[model samples]
Target: MTGTASVADMDQLGADVARPTLRGLGARWRQRRTAAAQLRHLTTYAGRPLVALTTTVHLLAGAAPVVFMIGTGAALQHLDDGGAMPWLALAIGAFLGQQLLAPVQLVLSKAVARRVDAACLTRFTAFALQRAELATLERPEVADRLAQADEAFEQWTLTPGAAVEGGLALVARYTQLVGAVVVLGVVAGPWVALAGAVVALVARAGQTEAFFRWGQLIRGFQPLRRRATYVRELATSTRAAKEIRTLGLVDWLDERYAAENRAVLDPLWRWRRRVYGVPFLTYAAVALAGSVAGLVAMARSAEAGQVGAAAVAVQGLVLCARFGVMFPESDVKLVYGRSAWEALLEFEAQAQHDAGPQAAPTEGRITPAQAITAREVRFGYRPDRPVLDGLDLDLPVGTSTALVGVNGAGKTTLVKLLTGLYRPDGGTVAVDGVDLRDLDAHAWQRAFAITFQDYLRYEMPLRENVAMGAIEHRDDDDGIAAEVRRVGLGDLLDGLPLGLDTPLTRALPGGRDLSGGQWQRLALARSLFAVRHGASVLVLDEPTAQLDARGEAEFYDQFLDLTRGVTSLVISHRFSSVRRADRIVVLDGGRVTESGSHDELVDLGGTYARMFEVQARRFGGTDGSSTGAGDDEMRTVQA
Candidate 1:
């Protein structure tokens, strides 16, 4: 009725009433297969003995319903004889057995499901974290799929135990139907049981189709759900709480949330209209009429002395059990369970593909000894807009080098490349003339201790916070305390309630949050802690930006002492702060425009000299002596 098939359309449609329905069935089957495989895999984590125990108990529970029906029929038959009290007792016992088993089955099902969930979540989360490239984690598409996969096991009704219960229910119901048919054939005829089974199957198919449609609607709502959640978080989040109130955007966000709700619900309403307006009502009417007709036919046969009261009773019970073979909740679970597995597998494959190839080092790995050199290295987030084009640089062993660049001049990108978070698109970054790609990335990374401009504040104990940088020394309280003292946090330790063991954030009970400057100092301590753990190179990317002028000067002096013989590359835009480096390189438009010590650069009177002069003047140093203006004057006089 939905589509009038012409000859050509019939060819396309084949024999199915709805092509989409057939496709849905196929997809559902595939998903079920995937879910079954995953469930089997989950059993490994759930322990085989527990699974077997639960499964055995569940099978016994499944037979209880059929046993109750058969026992009741026998009791009804013996009631006419007036002496078979044991049959009545058997019937009552079977009924009580079903009731008793329900709670035990429910508890066992939940226990199995929870164990499976824990195991699956752990495996999938580990899979997500194992991507070799950082870029794969940043993709929004990948994030969306990952979120869906993560949500799969959270729904109780969609759990593995529930899915198994659904299958067992089918088997139980069909078993009852068989017993009913044999009983009916002895009393009335086989036609009555046959008619009932046909009607029940048809009715079940209709009900399942409706639920499958509902499942599809739910799937479509996922994006809207994500959007609504994001908007709601913005409305209620601490980070946006002040701005939301100040900007008076409460009503606006409320309207947007409502709009998202409507977007999700409107199409669902239309679908409901189609489902209930005619087709569902017709299905209900036909099923009800057919079932009533069958019962009436059995009653008439009894009146005519062709069937006994037991036959009529058994036929009714069998009809009820047949309808229980499939249910809306079970169908929904089947559909969504499949969806979750599909999303997880798809996301894992995509993440691996997007990570590209990270081959293990083919050549023997060696630590950088002489110098780390970037020779014509190139890269960019976008293919068309290259960030580091033919960039060349060098940092010799045990010498401090400062790299100064304007914003987006590839300083952070270069740091990522050096740390092997990204691979260069052209030429090579080499350590002592060995191509970096040929060296083990992990081995190479151990040579440098880095602190970026944006550092994390781990909401953990102060000791663990600092010790995370060198995890081997995590239990070494003395080493952690020494590093904290070296970073100027020794004074604050005396005031802290738990000293090094104090939690770093108020999120935990009795925890304390640190000031911005305190966190920065802790970050420095972390880097220095790594230094104690055998890291020979230090890379600081504006790590002291949060510190005041006095603090900056004091920390830098301490830094210079700690890294006196360590190969270090300091990235900063504050010209005065980096003047103490053994050599300074100025980058402009993705290339090294100038390179020298402070005096040589001033004598050269190149880009570095101009930058220093402007910065010095801003700081009220008109004489510019601090910026090597004396070098320029002395060179001029010599000429």
Candidate 2:
């Protein structure tokens, strides 16, 4: 029973083996199809003239060696006949042409490669921006694909340019191989040519299969590579420099980078050893045996006068040339380049899925006539942890509402949901009774002007930085200037060498970096510029955190005038700032725990009142008229 299987069992075992083989063949066919499509795509970017020229050079270069061998062999035959100058000249011309073509091919390939790379990078950037929500970008799988697509130029990786170039070279290699086989067949016999062809192809196929397996293995390590790269970046980042030096974390960071890299490489090394060892020896042995047998057969034929001197010479050269086609560099480039292309395709598919269906133009640009409301909204970054459960809130048109909460109370999360940056896990955020999901995401986001705690400090001209808020109206120079003054950045702008034209970061020539308070004001100007260009809703989250007490007070004094006709939501820890809003809402346990005017909430003596008292006591007074005390001292005084 152990030694002999029934017919049904045999059939099942055969089916299993055949299934995997068929699947492998299907995968290879798909890979080849993808490679062909990518080649055509790359050539389109490289332009027809350049591609044509490069291809012609590669083919001629590949055929040059075969021509040289035939010419030399003919020259040797003519020497016996005492007239060899023409044949010798032909041989010399072919050799020199091969040498000269090398540099020409290199230059052309580089040019084509650069153009293809630029086009691919541009497409990648466009794809990244296609997604309407931020949640998809944060997914681990998407991030891994992004990293893989981006890091195609590493030594271990292959760029699209390299892949296309390798593909061309592979075609040339086969040309050379076929030319050698044909010459051998004519000079010797069909059997010798067939044997040589078989040996070369089998060896090349085995080597190619090994490289393809290696590529597949490395693809699984993309996440590991991403983690390692992130660790490396953290160790070198300017933002983290101060903390790293203070904490003496250089060695710790180095260890972490090494650990992450090892996690990727150890398995790779083990796989290579197991996969490459025996197969490599077998290929080498086959190549060696085939070469010796073919050479010996030609030598015997020549000695017996079965073939002429020219035929003998041609056979010898062709035998050697056939093995040269088995060079592994082109194969490696093709495999790695194909892998990079596949990564890009994978990312594109995910991005399209994340973007979902596109809404019609008219239906997309919805504006709330009465209110934006959240009803029973539930959300969390992780499934097990719920951040906002059954949260309900309303922002009435043309009114200022302040949102107050302790840390981790989902104030920021709520703002994100309202702005369509993220969707709730359950329930709906509606604009004047219309669910946000039914609206065009871009148009919905464009309706609000927001300033967050961690606003981006763009290292560009100050004019461009402010104009980024509403790019279509960047030419409205007067409006830009007015908003600058409104945000209290007029003096800073006047002091600049080029005024609004001056670059924001010191990294550029003659550029200046602003202090934290000035940058905060600049961020405010950017958001206000959006309002000036027709953004109907204004959202400010810790907008004045970097400002001093006087600056904060000045901002609050102008707040009502700034947001007079816009629906506004301001999130701040300061009771003074919250008091400036028409309505104050306290967020606790993912719900609106308190909703009233600041004075009303303070009078009610609930969570908002207790928090306001604690903050006010710690600061001595909200108006900065009294000396502030430390946390422990405030607690002791209260006790």
Candidate 3:
């Protein structure tokens, strides 16, 4: 079950089929416990005063129904006597109390709900960010759980006022039922009361189970909805608009979007219909039968003089109210809320388990002043497909080394391991002879400045984007501007309206977008800024992929000049850019196949020389244009 292999296995079976296995009473108990924990956690944020006020108000309001019923019955009975006005007053007072308290409770409940939601969201997001391991975040199961928890929270926490009121009503309804049955047990008979109570409880249990089952289906359905949303966005968003039109794929994309929507919603509809069919019908049948029988028994008692007309009316009222508490809106709300709470707890547990060792390093944080070495490193994103196997590499201090490899040769994986973003499954990544696992993670990260091929576009102010590399320099405009100039963005900045303050995306007012090459330059500037901030190691994974050959060569020349004494690892497809490195290592099948200077590798005439020759011939044509024969050769070599 390590890595993504289990995720693939689960995906093949479908998330719906591989749903959580907890069942029956155990599942119900777990859900209840989760809900209780959520409520308890919310109080930490919502404040005790608000919770107390809301509970008291809702409880009073909820109990009003039963009180009003009894008051009305008593007042009606007292009509022939002189005591009617006082009884009437009692009923009116109770009614007014509910009315007066409702708006206040609702307002307080809403306020508390918002605070609780903010607290939960902030804590959950922080927990996800602060965890030391990236593997948990990379897991599909963990991701889905997070999404489900968020959805659940949003759906339920928004209507705190309603939830409070509904919960109180449920309690009040059950209390009234018990009281009614007790009265019947005395007047009608214990046997009749026992039968009615049994039927009512059975119906309630069935309805609860139905809602729980529906929640499970909805959780499983979330992935499908996400897929549908992605497809729809691709069909409609401006990013994909050009491709859709140029490729004549507008109709095709629309069809795909429609298919995705159907794929998500069709099963949902079926599940909903099925859920509302037999299980709900059974509840309805039991409820109807119990209500009718209870009413009939009450009427017979009145007719037989076993009870008064007021008593009979009270019994009937309680019977009707028993079914009233089975309101679908409230039940569904609780189900969604509880399900979310359960998911949140589940994810927290999983993340806690995945967290790295908590013990402080005995040797404290060690800076990598000498070199970083991976000895017999092993890693895999899946159980069966090892991405890096027995990888042994060294990033020597104070030198530039170029890593060249074909696709799937573990070049990027090595960079990740070296940077300590991922720990190898076996063996060791050591910095200055100290294992990475023993060093302080934050200090270890500060040792390297890395830029991956798929770098982020922050869509923030241009200054913040570069300054993010070193937060202490975030407000240092002069220093940021200096880095910008160094990266050759001075002319570009001069053209912008707000200069460094301007946002990178056109989505914001007064913002402007940069060309891909410009962004790549900005990324390099950020990395250089990190080095300026005392980072000892600089790693770039396909940093010049967006640049032309000339641009890439220029970047490499500048890179070497800027990082003259810093330990640097550069991965590039261009041989010209990589050949300038002090040392070049050719990786093939997760192992270093050749290690030497470019001339030495070429002289060896191994895989590196073959690749170099292929790329070299692409530029070595007769008329400054690559020949078709060379293209064929490249394709043949690559294949």
Choose the strongest candidate by lDDT: 2
Tens digit of lDDT per residue, candidate 3, span 1-639?
Answer: 112223234244344432335564686788667665655665567778877776676667666655665666667667776776877787898889878876876676667666766666676777677652678877766766677766556565523323333443354456556665565565556545765686667677766666666777766666665566567767777787878899999888788888877766666666666665676777778777776676666556633342234364545345743653456435765666555555666787887787657436334224567888989988998878888888888888999999987767788888888877788899899988988887766667777778888888788999998987887778878878888888778998888899889999998999989889889989988888888887888888888777765676567668778889999999876676688789999887777868999889888988777777777676793222221223344335645
TM-score of 1: 0.82
Error of 2 at 445 (Å): 1.8
TM-score winner between candidates 2 and 3:
2
Ranking by TM-score: 2, 3, 1
Q: In candidate 1, which residue pairs get closer than 3 Å at backbone N, Cα or C atoms, i.e. clash?
A: none
In model 1, the runs with Cα more than 4 Å from the true position are 1-48, 152-189, 207-213, 245-252, 268-286, 296-332, 357-367, 430-448, 622-639
Q: TM-score for candidate 3, please give it.
A: 0.84
Candidate with maximal TM-score: 2
Worst-scoring 10-residue span by lDDT in model 1? 1-10
RMSD of 2: 7.0
lDDT of 1 at 352: 70
Write down the TM-score of every candidate: 0.82, 0.87, 0.84
Query: Model 2: per-residue lDDT, tens digit, 531-555?
Result: 8888899999989888887888899
Lowest lDDT sum, 10 consecutive residues, model 3, at 622-631
**lDDT (10s digit) by residue, model 1, range 537-588:** 8999987778777777787666668779899999876765687889999876
Clash list (residue pairs), candidate 3: none
